[model samples]
Every structure is written in C-alpha cells, then in structure tokens.
Target: MPRYNMYYPDYEKLYPGIEKRPDILRVLRASDRKMRYMEKGLKLERSVWDRKKQTIASLPSREISLEELMEDGRQQFSNGPTLDEQVQHQEELRHLHQALCSLEREYQLLLYFRYWKDMSQEDVAKMLSLTQQAVSYRERYALQRLKDFVQNGEKKKF
Candidate 1:
C-alpha cells in the first residue's frame, strides 16, 4: 500500500476515481477537518482530566475530614470478598492482569480506555492520534486476545 501523504497530488491518487468529483473531495476534506477538530477536543478534555487528577492529589491532608477518611477506608475494605470469593476473584484478576500486561503497549492502553472507560471508537482514535480504522483493528485484536486468554485459561483449569 502507498504511504498516505496529505499533499494534493498524493491524496488525489489515494482515493482514485473519487478525486475527479470536487463535491466528493469537498466532503472528504470536510470530514477530515471534523475529525481533526474532534481530536483537538479530546486532547483538551484529556488535559483537563489530568489536571483534575493532579488537583485531587494535591489537596491538603488536613482538608480531608475524619468521616470522609473513615468512609474511604470502609469502602476500600468492603470492596474485597469473603475468603472463598476472594480466592476466586484474585485468581481471575491475576490472570487478567497478566494478560493485560502481556499485550502490545498501544493495544493494552487502548483496550483499557475503550473497554474500561467506555470511550467511543472515534474518541479513542482521537486520543491515540490514530485513524479510526487503526483504532478499530487494535480494539478488535485486543479483545480477541483477551477472549483467547480467558478461554484457554478456563480450559487449563478444567
């Protein structure tokens, strides 16, 4: 495949017959512009989220009330399970964490953002500085890998 070049002559050849239609080219250019804008917006939002996380971290210890501290402790403790449940949960978590760690760097992070954070494909692509198609492929591959890991693990245990 030809390397994608944004220059007029190159883009014209990239799309082939569509290049002859000014209207189609206009639409394609508009779509590209829109995608660029969305990418910018996602970047700004990520920056904002980073700042928020930092601000929360930087809050004064004294500002955290005793009740709030107690509640946080309680919540953390309660999030775990009883002994047997804990064993099962821990096993599953360990396998999943290992699988996640073993994934390609980009695929792992993108999978987390897409699956855990519930980000849309377009949003993920924008955030990752990749095209929609690239994001789709990575997401599909990551999911398939995860599924295979889980299935094979279950088979081994049984």
Candidate 2:
C-alpha cells in the first residue's frame, strides 16, 4: 500500500514491519536517494545516446563516387577534437594519474585491476587473495580517497 512501490517493489516482503523501525526506514530513504540519483544519470545517458542516434540517422544517406570521397575526406574528418581539447584531456589524464599514484600500492593495484582491466570485484578478490567483502570495502575506500584528492585540487597527498 506504500506509494514507494514503484521505487521499492515488494517493500513489505523485503522489509517486514519497516514502518515500525526508524533505522530501517532511514536506510531505505538513503537507498531511495541513491536509486533516484542513478536513475537520473541513466536517463541523461540514454537521452544523449538517443540524440546521437537521431543525429546519425538524419545524415544524408546517398552514395558518393570515389572522386567525391577523395575530395571530401579531409573536410569530413575535420570535426574531431581540437588541439586545445586534446591538450586539456591529456592534462586531465595526467592529474588523474597523479591522484592514482598517491594511493597506497594495494589500492592502486585494486583500482587498476578493477577498472583498467575491467575485472569484476570477485575476480579482483581472487587475484588479490582477499575476501569479496574486503575487496569491496577497499575499493570504496580507495575511490573515496581519490575523490577527496581530486576535490582538494589534487594538492594533498593520500
């Protein structure tokens, strides 16, 4: 009967007597906030994807001769990132690398494996010889450290 069934389906089955427990209610509210945040992000991403698809679909679909292709190739590819944008992106990567380097070796390796190598948390745990829970904890701590470092203008050491 709760209005939040759209967000937390089967809420009664998942958290019986939730209304009687303030602690569980608080946790559920926090979870709802996180879910809403993620849902907004997903919506934004989907919108961008749809816009890109529409733009692509709206392009002319006529066939071009070899001479036309040769003549327009340079102009057609000139819409890439500008030099300033490329430089800025490189600088951002450098800043991120510095932040990553400031973390402890274990945290660095954990992030590298989990993100750079696209490994799952369970796989990372097996590789690092740690429990999944421990890996999860460390991953969260490490990301928080990186976020703090970046937010502090990347001047502070971890």
Candidate 3:
C-alpha cells in the first residue's frame, strides 16, 4: 500500500513557546485532535473520494508537516484507547458544559449539584432552598431543554 501523510495541526509550530510553556501543549494537542476529526469528516464526504483511483491518492489526504504515515485509520501518536477516548470525550463534554453554562442560574446549580457533584436530589433541594419535588421538576425541565437544544439547537434559549 502507498503511504500518505494525515494532517494533525502542529501544536509546536502554532504555539512557538511550547518548549517553554508545557501547559500550552495540552491545548494544542486538543487542537490537533480537532484537526484529525476534520480529516475523518473528509473521509465521510463521498465527493472528495474517488473509488476508481483505488490508491492512497484517491483518499482526501492532508499532508502533515510531521510526515506521519497514515498507515491505518487511527493516528500514529495514539498511545492507547484510554487517552484517545478521554480526549475526544472531553471535547464533547466541553461542548455540553458550554451549553449548560448558558442556562438559568438555578438550573445550572441544580444540574451541577445533582449530577456533577453527585449530591442527592433532596440535598440539592435543601441547598437551593427548594422542595425536593421542585428540584425534580427543574431537573426534568432543564434536561429536556438541554436535550432539545443539543439535538436541534434553534437558538440560545438559555
């Protein structure tokens, strides 16, 4: 099989101080992951691929400056399933969290205390000066809103 480079945005070049500021690497790596996700998208797009070519050239290949080989569907730097899933999940979770952030203060706290902090519904009610039933109602309402927003997302209802 022929070899081709899959583009992963170079975190190092983009962040010139990666050598000095190690923390920045984490953010850049996340950007690199998004870049990979974009490449996957190209694979999903039928127009970009030419079946007749039947070679690596037929694929929508992006050249990586790192010159990493696109030997398999997965990337070379993938350490293991654990970290890769976590990073991808964290990205998705971040999107959900941003949506949560836009919610009313009450619903935000209710979701955070009950779900994130792992507190009981009763505990959340007491903390928020609400009845347990009220907390339950808000939880249902908030979750329904979030679900609709995520699936359709007409606008920022929050």
Best by lDDT: 2
Error of 2 at 30 (Å): 63
Question: Which segments of model 3 are wrong by more than 4 Å?
Answer: 1-79, 82-90
Residue 67's lDDT in candidate 3: 32
Winner on lDDT (1 vs 2): 2
Q: Looking at model 3, report the run of 10 residues with the lowest lDDT sum.
A: 59-68
Tens digits of per-residue lDDT for model 3 on 1-158? 43334555555556676778777777766776777765565443224545788544343354443333554454656666687788999987876876787688989989989888999999998898999999999999999888876677535857
**Candidate 2, pairs of clashing residues:** none
18-81 in candidate 2: lDDT tens per residue?
Answer: 7788887778778987776555543222212356556532333344444456666634356689
- Whole-model Cα lDDT per candidate? 0.70, 0.77, 0.73
Q: List the residue pairs that clash in candidate 1.
A: none
**TM-scores for all candidates?**
0.43, 0.51, 0.44
Lowest summed lDDT across 10 adjacent residues in model 1 is found at: 40-49
Error of 1 at 60 (Å): 52
Error of 3 at 21 (Å): 68
Across 19-109, the per-residue lDDT of candidate 1 in tens digits comes to: 6799988877787776655444432222122564564322232343444568677443455468999899989899888777767788888
Instruction: Report how far residue 72 has shifted in candidate 2, in Å.
Output: 4.5
Which of the two, 1 or 3, has more TM-score?
3
